[model samples]
Target: MGVLTGKTALVTGASRGIGRGVAERLGRDGPRIAVHYGSDKTAAKETVAAIEAAGGSAFAIGVRLGMPGDADRLWEEFDRHADGLDILVHNAGIGTSRPFAEIGEEEFDRLFAVNVKAPFFLTRLGAERLRDGGRVVNISSGLARAAAMPQLIAYAMTKAALDVFTRDLSKELGPRGITVNSVAPGIVDTDVNAAWLRASEEAWQEAAALAALGRVGTPADIADVVAFLVSEDGRWVTGHWLDATGGSLT
Candidate 1:
């Protein structure tokens, strides 16, 4: 039997990239999944098809984060799709390459709305409805800690805020037999990042040099960690910032 058998999971931002990877991997464990996307209907449907083909359960749902009553709409989708939730992965986020000085109010507001605000509200709503001993996994980035790129200041800021939320939410949720934690990844190779990875080998090598593993990370790399955290085996872990960064911080 799989680790998360008979459970339900809701993964936001499952249209592509790391979020899609996580949802696909977790479906192997036999949990009914509600895959949420902003607007990529086709991508979301493809995810659903893949899951069903593999004999796993999944459904596509959509919501525009930062909209009024977004929480209500999100919960409605979950309720209509699944009876209850056992795991919630807050993986929806956006980041730009704009420098801090060049960052505009709209950009900051947009990122925060998705990266920070939506997660917070979703967690609040999810916690109340989640079964006892539920798990909440928030996808953070190593950039929150080592956000050295000048062009990534705003993105890093949102992640840093997410870290704080992860910690505080864990404390509040712990007493309810629920666990909350964050997973930070460094440079995972995925379609969304193909442009960057397609660059010069020298540039790639420089980036890889920072990783103790001497290579770049893959979507599966981060997904595996998230799957473990959402499983029964991860019960004792909570309020942690687990690094799936190939020991980049080590």
Candidate 2:
């Protein structure tokens, strides 16, 4: 049996990209994964199928975030499947590519609503159902600490807020032996960045050059980091922002 054979993990936005990677990785450890998707039911099912094909257990849960009662709605759906949670991976987030000056109020609010508020409230509610010694891993971005792209100012701000939440929540959940941390990645080659990143050879090369490793990061890279964090090996580590950035921040 794997290390997490009997555990239950909820990975938000598991339909695609980094979130899907995390879900699949954790599922491989034998946990019963709740594959959360915003609106893509088909993609969510595919994620579940992939996990099952790997000899893992998983089910899809769909709920649109950034709304008034998103967290509550999500938990309600989750309640139908499991009674408790052992791991909570808050990976669902939206990004804004608009420059600071061009971003409108609605756009900024929407970003915060989906990226920050959703996770904030979701964690608050999930904590009650989370077992002692459970894990809470928040997917953060390197932009939170560095001004990597001025155009993504609003997106960076949301991640910054998430990091703060990670730090503070760690203290709150420490007594229960629940570890909370933020894993910040840099320039990961996921579907989210595929459009601009794959536009030209020069574009891809420039992105790769930003990382000290001389190549762009992959979803698997981030997933491996998260797998370590949620495992028994990471029990003593908490309240930290892990840089899974391929040395980009260096």
Candidate 3:
């Protein structure tokens, strides 16, 4: 049996990218995975299929976050599949590529709504369903700690807020043995970054050089870190911000 054979994990935005990676990894570890998606039901189905094909079980749930009553809708759907949660990976988020001066109010508000607010209320409302000794991980960005991408100023702010949430929530959930942490990645080569990162050799190499490891990160790299964090080996770790950036911030 796998380490997490009886556990249930909810990975938000698991339809693609890092979220999908985490879902698949956790599912392999033997958890029943709830693959949550925003609107891409087709993609979500594929994610579930991939997990099942890999000898893991998973189901897909659709709920657009960052809206009023969104958290309520999400949990309601989750209730249809599982009784409780052992892992919560908050990976759903939106970003703005415009510079700070060009970022409009709506864009800023939307960033906070999806990236910061959604997870905040989701955890608060899902507390009852979150089992004692559960794990919570927020997928953060290296931009939250560095000014490497000033164009994503608003987006960086949202991640910074999420890190703060992780720190404080760890304390609040400590009594129940729940661990909360922020996993910050840098220049991961996911679909989201494929267009730009693959545009040219120079673009790719420049991104790779940012990390001391001299290679661009992949979804699997981030996923492995998350797997460690949610496992029994990570029991004593809580309220920490781990740089899964391959030494990019060094």
Error of 1 at 73 (Å): 1.2
Please give the distance, in angstroms, between residue 134's alpha carbon in candidate 3 and its true position after superposition. Answer: 0.5
lDDT of 3 by residue, 123-221 (tens): 999999999999999999998897567788889999999999999999999999999999999999898999999999999999999999999999999
lDDT tens readout by residue for model 2, 96-171: 8899889999999999999999999999988899999999999999999986678999999999999999999999
Clashes of each: 0, 0, 0
Clashing pairs in 3: none
Winner on lDDT between 1 and 3 is 3
Candidate 3 global TM-score: 0.99
Worst 10 residues of 2 by lDDT: 145-154
Q: What lDDT is reached at residue 97 by model 3? A: 87
Write candidate 1's Cα lDDT for 105-205 as tens digits.
98889999889989998888777789989999999999999738889988988999999998998889898889989999998787767777768887788
- TM-score against native, each model: 0.96, 0.99, 0.99
Candidate 1 structure lDDT: 0.89
Model 2 CA deviation exceeding 4 Å by range: none
Which 10-residue span in candidate 3 carries the lowest summed lDDT?
146-155
